[model samples]
Target: MSKVPANEDFYKVHLLNEWSWKLTTPLDAQPHTIDGNHIFEVIFEGNNTDTVCANDGHVELKFAISAMEQRNPRMPRLKFVRGLSTQFEFAMASLHTNFIRGRFGLQLLFVSNESVIPGEDFRLESLFSINDEVTPGIFEMVNIKLGERDNSTTSTLKSHSNTPQSSWPTGFIQARPVCYTSERYREVKASRDAKLSKQRTVLNTSDQELLLPRTLPYLFYAQRIKPTDDPHEVVGMRLQNISFGTPGDGYYAHSSFIVWTISFGFGEPPIDTLSPLLIGLITLSAVVVLGSLLFGTMLILIFQRRYRFGEFQRLTETDTTSAVST
Candidate 1:
């Protein structure tokens, strides 16, 4: 069938095959761009040309299956999507703004041609990170605490997830993101702006919240932090272990979404919340100091009372002697 939405460019889908894409639009270099592409070129479809633009160049995907099964027992899977469906949609508004939240936003949607099984979800491990490099002071991974909010309370993922994060805080301190220039990729660097310190990034309360990806309630957004340390780990988040769909569950049985908005090049990534261990230590110290003060106050009162009592007795004896002499 012909592609829908007449004004949009056609995107081809693939199944059981390795595919690539290149955007028809040429990369333009000027203000924020060094070449035709934005300095931090967000790429898709394993295609050098499919760079995401400020335009709502949303790509849509669907899956179709044949009755006749094709066997490839000898071939090992090199990528997750190779064995899944072929079509995909990278949806986002092409809004370009100076603010980090406004500048970059993207989402990937995947639907099933057939019902899926438990533990049979498409996933991409280590989506993006520079950890493969031998360079020093470099690693990758946005250290999301084990119990961070992986999904909304009403989200299917949250209900189905074995790990409950109802009590966990949705905060992350560090992530290593690399930007793609027209030429190549490079590691992100941290800034030593006066407002930042190792303990925290933003000095001002308003700016502190600015570090959060306030734009959307993304599934995972450790992609950009204002920058805790210069090195983003060898970690890029791609689709990972989405087991929401099942063959007989009905409406949502065959589809799952790998949705996230990029919070790159912002003022600072969200800073770390105080750990329980630190909070406990502070509380213990306060208790100790207060106990010492209370003990010292008691000793001072006792000494003062004793001194007054002894002086009063001496005065009484002197007055008695003077009366007898008179």
Candidate 2:
């Protein structure tokens, strides 16, 4: 295959550092059907093309990214580099708190063509066979809000993490590898093992607690759909669904690549119950209504004053004319 050109079509750029890891098995995005306060489902279909290789299998997992934002006011944005890539790996599992579990062996595929070309948006498609081996795992989709007294980032992560693993609303447990076996597949495994070990150090840290609240219940779509036009890219997610964090409680909102969307708040609330977004909307509407009424009253008073002055002038002129005639 010829080298894919970096052109206007790409909207995102993958800044891979020296320590970055890549996934050999590609993922596809499934369609979005259900909407809830704290749960989402994205199904992906995996594919395995190469044959006659040893590592033949299909696998899938439930993945989610913590929404982290910058502390600088002028530069509020989502931070994708956690010394980790945004792609979720499902194989080398070490239990994560709550419902989500991550594998140390997953790699992410980034877009070569960044342009937002129609039918060209990066997508996740169905995962399929690798070397004819079957992968395992049941994936459940869930959205979680922060708990009381939590930061936007922390609240979001805890909301999801608090859910019992046994209660994973949706996820995958795969026994088969989701890719085709190739002669060079062994190298991929070795690289994955090393990467997983390193990531384990980071994933097991307290810094993994940031999250934006408006996008609360961060939705995870299963990896089943792939970008149709470019194998270099996949399209399935509706970028329009991206939203800013609720600004009601002095929270700021913004967008970022790798994580796509994120939001922040000043302090933590009963995230599980506090709907700052809803409260904010109500407050804004009330302000607008009140302002409109005040403005309308002021306009009416001004017009009434003008009308009365004109009438008084007319009466005075009539009296003067009558006196003069008499």
Candidate 3:
């Protein structure tokens, strides 16, 4: 019989497997523009080996931007979306300029896909931190804490006793944004309720509202920086935060993520004296050319009429002279 591996060896193997799931972004050490409509792309690749394909799990990615400190207790939480493939891309147009200028936190949560059993309770807690100063376009993900739990594990096993079974982990698979202001909170809640109503036809509506926690207990903080001298210049961003579950559970965690600031300058060019002056010159040149052509045409017509009149006068004078000579 084969002997079981020791704890150290087991953890090492697990790490190796986990490392196989690679996260990649297109920045390549370049700063991201803070311009409102930047496109961010992230790719997740996994080996199709048995260990990685234990249950054909998929990945979900989420992110949020918040100030380094919350002056308002009612800040919105992160936004999340499930990835259908290895590559995930989204536009950052929704990011508010005021919220992005300072030291803000950018939280990314990754989750594996799992079946949701009815009547089961699940929970998740995640935290990450940066080990060093993150410069514009330069940062790394370190100290990642990703965990989940499900209460219906034993019952689900019993129900599938006679069939082939594989253990699957289940828990919260998405992030919910927390809005600080009452008006914003109401707006978000109404949007969510509307979405839930539409999804009720296809999914269990009872649990849809419970998928995300209603409270904003965790505070995400970052160090704020001054705006750059140039509006179009890119800047560096450093983010830090602590996230945990209910107190006394000792599940607290901290993590850091970096964002490169970029600016695409989406609006029209700045209005300047030179622009107006050039436009005026061009308009004046066009008018002058048109006026010259009109005057030249009129002169030609006048010259032709005068020349015909002179020819008629000479013919009449010549006829009068011949008659007088006869």
Best by TM-score: 1
The per-candidate count of clashes, in order, stands at 22, 86, 20
Could you tell me which 10 consecutive residues in candidate 1 have the lowest summed lDDT?
191-200
Question: Distance (Å) between predicted and true CA of 123, model 2?
Answer: 31
Q: Backbone clash tally for model 2?
A: 86
All candidates in order of lDDT, best leading: 1, 3, 2
Give the per-residue lDDT digits (tens) of candidate 3, residues 1-326: 11125854322121222334556544573345423323234445443343323444323232322212111122221221122111121111111112111222222222222222344322322232231121111122211111222444342222224644344332222222121112223332222100001010112223222321221211121111123333112111111222212223211111111112111111111111223655677789999999999999999999999988887533576666765433
Worst 10 residues of 3 by lDDT: 192-201
Query: Which regions of candidate 3 are displaced past 4 Å?
Result: 1-87, 94-114, 128-148, 153-163, 167-326
Candidate 2 lDDT tens digits, 1-326: 11124783432221112112334323354323322221222323232332211133333332432333211111111122221212232221111211122111223321121122333322222233221111112121112111111111211111224755334222111111122112123222221101111110111112112211122222322121222444223211222112212223121111110111122222221111224665677789999999999999999999999988887533566666665433
Where does model 1 exceed 4 Å of error? Answer: 1-45, 50-102, 108-276, 279-283, 303-307, 310-313, 316-318, 321-326
Shift of residue 205 alpha carbon in model 2, Å: 45
lDDT of candidate 3 at residue 212, scale 0 to 100: 19
Q: What is the C-alpha RMSD of each candidate to the true structure, in Å?
A: 21.7, 23.0, 24.5
- Identify the runs in model 2 with alpha carbons over 4 angstroms from their true place: 1-274, 314-326
